[model samples]
Target: MNILQAKNEIKNTVQAYLSKNSFGEYEIESKNQRPLLLIGPPGIGKTQIMEQISKECQIGLVSYTITHHTRQSAVGLPFIQEKEFQGKTYSITEYTMSEIIASVYSKMEETGLKEGILFIDEINCVSETLAPTMLQFLQNKTFGNQKVPAGWIIVAAGNPSEYNKSVRDFDVVTMDRIRYIHVETDYYVWKEYAISKHIHPMILSYLELKPNNFYTVSTSVDGMEFVTARGWEDLSYLLYSYEKMLLEISQDTIYEYLHHEDIAEDVFAYYLVYKKYQDDYGIDDILNGNVSSSIYARLFNADFDERVSVVNLVMDGLLRQVNIYSFEKHCTDLWFGFLKNYRNHMDVSYVDHVKEFIALYHDKLQAELLSDAQKHEYEFVLEQIQKVNVDASLDSKSRFDCSTKPFFKQKENMESIESDLKLQIENAFEFMESAFKNGQEMTIFVTNLIMSAEMALYLSSHTIGIYEKYKQVLLIGSQKARLLDELAH
Candidate 1:
């Protein structure tokens, strides 16, 4: 149901066919070899799975998009040239895609290659002009204008018809030629594989937190998307590298997909779900539950509006998965009792995906009680929730279309009084005293008075006068003369 299982299924099917006999020309291979058509919403890992299969099978992979190549490139005529020098002539042939096809055949003859897989991505986008040429290749294993080499397998991928708005519907003729696989979001399966691969801790956390939201847009279809194994892998790396910033980026990414500004509703819904489950069944009880009659009733209720509640429930369950192992039974029991007593009426079935997820959580209470792996996963989930919060906050902040009152308004009287006081103080000490110039020392008496007043105006106004008077007194004393004698001298 998830990406990994789909990949194994595809590879196993193809490898089986290749083992039986060598498929002929690329066109013939399309006609004879196994051709798989992966159909999924954008971001689901269709093309990547094929690439992986190619590596695992040890076969060469030639990948191209239908949008990138034209009928001219697919089947047009090419140029040939000859050069004559010193009575000897050398000839060289230049062919178009048609001629290239012939060369591949020639090489296949010489090398006896069994076949290489041809991956055509975005096949739904093949232009009108190229369709017939491609049809020719698909039908006869040969270009309209030339022959194709043997030993080639064909695999084409595109967005699913329902989700993709742009792809021209494939006619019965084209549909008949290939086997189809539909990829959907499988959170638990992906989490397991991602963890096994030692994928980035952050990525694991995000998936565990909100499995439905993590996905990529498919390249071919406008508005079409697919979740891929690669995306999860990339997310793991991103979380590991940019731990704190990961949440912000994730929110922006998810925001684009959801196409909505108010994600808090979804987040709140999830929190409620987590609380309900944490209270109803012990974390262990929920994880170990097989198919409970009550659980099934909660999951597939016909009367209630499912869409409004399902996502929140699923998200909460994932959050709980990473955080629960660290919880002590007594604590869990106490919490459950509290929930049952306080909120016995609340529905918690939103987060009951048992066998799929192991226990994990962010709270130290949960981490301390859980296993090492559970704690790590729980922390990652917490990080993801934080990312969602950040994204929501930033997006909401940016929308400042709503009016807000200014904070800390300046009082007119206070402002004017402060301004006047500052000006008066500045004016009182506009000129510096000579004694206070850079490094000049003050008279002991002046220093004592200045230190006491702690007022620049008082000090500045009297500083020079006091210094002058002290100097005159000192001079009169040094010369041993009265004031009148000094003046006469």
Candidate 2:
């Protein structure tokens, strides 16, 4: 299975495991519920999805890499205790709470969530002495003498034996005690996540052009070399940052993230080409519906790679505007919701009330562990709310009126941005029509927009003439292809 499918499956399993009976006890007893074990290659988003699962389930999360722990730490430190047996006192060993177990309780207290996922990474790579303890922990849901809380689910992950020298294969008995999922590298699945994350379109385009390079791991004379989804995502952040800072991205910078030398150099070469294309073409001019004849001629004469690069360039620009619109809409809607809720309170000290609201939201967000986009929205909302600077001495109405200005201006600016975005969409279509016409480039442009969550939303809400027309063209083309395939069959 792919990581996304694994995520959905794991999420469903977690929900089902947490479901309660009429007596409020879990339907699946804690001891009866086998732990979830994920086996996959390293850096393929195995560890990344745990937090997402916890957040989606509205539960607490405690994560640890078991390879870092010694047997003592994993099972807790043993201490001497006195007990009476057969009317005689004897010494017995009792262990303190394991750090892993303690963390679950701490998270439960901090987040006010009784149920959650305790995710242990590199479970198969634990030290030799800790292997038995791990098996026992998996079989019994215990670290030391403390069983995991009733509502909590235990999920463990590890790199496959081929990926790590220290990996230990579980016996049949241990295997049957848990449910295991094997995940492989999947570009399309990761692409869906990467697109939502707004990974550099250059990376997306390169991967689309050379899907084989999306994930490559091998041993060579120089040593292990690989390119992972994590590397691409981190590189995307660096590229965007460097672009903003006007810093040159050297081949060494690409090499730093993408470990596979061949793939890294190939991507760096594409980066150079992309930059050159950006310099050669005026994206702002295209978005404004002012296409020079020379530019149109260059595009018309360009090859498939050049055309794809240009399409990606335009998409990068479109994504920028659409993301801003999304952020604004999210922030404004949330802020406006607060305002609507606070409207019933007509007393003084609304500023303090608003401040409390912001602080509570901030604290809750820390516990919820939202995705990158949502985190940005929440941060922006809090910042805007803080900057409102309403005079607390004034009456409630006056204070509310003063506090509302920030979102008011934000909403107005959002409207103006939407207008500009609509014009840009129409103009983008016009450029595609004049230059690429009904070529695959048009299909690429329309298909990508339809795939994007924000772009799809924007397109659905606003009826741009050329955009709507191209969408119909795409629909008809898809139907025709399907019909032709049917006839051929």
Candidate 3:
């Protein structure tokens, strides 16, 4: 399964494992719950998903790399204690709580979440001496004598032996004791993720032209040469930051993230074309429905690869609009919910659900579970909420009137965003129809929009005429030009 599918499966597994009985005890006892073991290649997001799962499930998380621990550290240090055996007193050895287990408890206390996931990375790459301890923990959910906290799910991720020679294959006994998920790389699946994440448009466009380069793991004389989804996302961040700073990205920088030479050089070459499009075609102008005839003439003269890159460029802009709409809608929802509740009640009790959203965002931000995009969204919303500081000294009605003023802007912003996005969508389709004689560009744009949950959500309440036509054209290839012409007329 792909990482997204794996994420869903693991989330479901965690929820099922944590299901409670009528008396509030776990439906399945702690001992009976099989710890989840995720086996896959490195850099496939096994580690990242745990943090997302923890945040989404509103649970505590304590993560560690097993390779970073020795047996003593993993199982805790031993100490001498006095014990009475029958009539005689004897010295006994006892171990303190394992640091890993202690961290789980710490998170539970810190977050006030009794249930969570304890994620162990590189579990099979532990030192030989710690291998038995690893297996023991997997089987018994214990690090030495201290068992994992009840209601906390144990999830471990490890690269397969093919990816890491250090991997210790679990025996049948150990394997039978856990729920194992084997993950693989799928470019289309990752593409959806990449689009949602707003990965560097150039990287996305380049990969779209060359899907084979998306995930590569091969052996060469120089050693193992590989590229993975992790590499692409990291590269995306650096590209975004470097471009923002107006710093020139070198071939070496690309190779640093993507170790494969052939793939790196190919991407670098395509990146030059992306820059060419940036310089030649005013993409923002195009999205605003202002396209010069000379620009279309230049595009017609360009090759298919460059045309595809341009399509991705246009799609990237449209998606950005969708992203903005999505964020504004969420912020508006928070304010709307709060005001609704406050208006219904005589007092601003519980401050409505806005406080919950704020608290949740703060908790995730504190835990560093939110991605950069999420962090910014949370911060912006937090800033907006802070501006409407409700004064307790004022009467309830006055307080509501003063504080509710800022949220009114959110409502207006949402309306403006909808209008802008609808116009942008129409402009993108118009430009796609005019620039390319063949409908592949429109095909690419419409296909991506269809895949976007954000676009689907926006379109539920909004309508785009060309989008409806293109969706039908997608089903009938022969009708693509007819549909484009129909929309054009």
| Cα error of candidate 1 at position 422, Å | 72
Candidate 3 lDDT trough over 10 residues, lowest sum: 480-489
Top candidate on lDDT is 2
lDDT of 1: 0.45
The 0-to-1 C-alpha lDDT of every candidate, in the order given, reads 0.45, 0.84, 0.82
Decreasing lDDT order of the candidates: 2, 3, 1
Model 3 Cα displacement at 95 (Å)?
0.6
Model 1's number of clashes is 37
Best by TM-score: 2
**Error at 257, model 1, angstroms:** 8.3
The true-versus-predicted C-alpha distance at residue 10 of model 1, in Å, is 2.7
Give per-residue lDDT, candidate 1, residue 384.
Answer: 29
- Which 10-residue span in candidate 2 carries the lowest summed lDDT? 480-489
TM accuracy, model 3 = 0.90
The runs of at least 3 residues in candidate 2 whose Cα sits more than 4 Å from the true structure, single-residue gaps closed, are 369-379, 382-406, 472-489
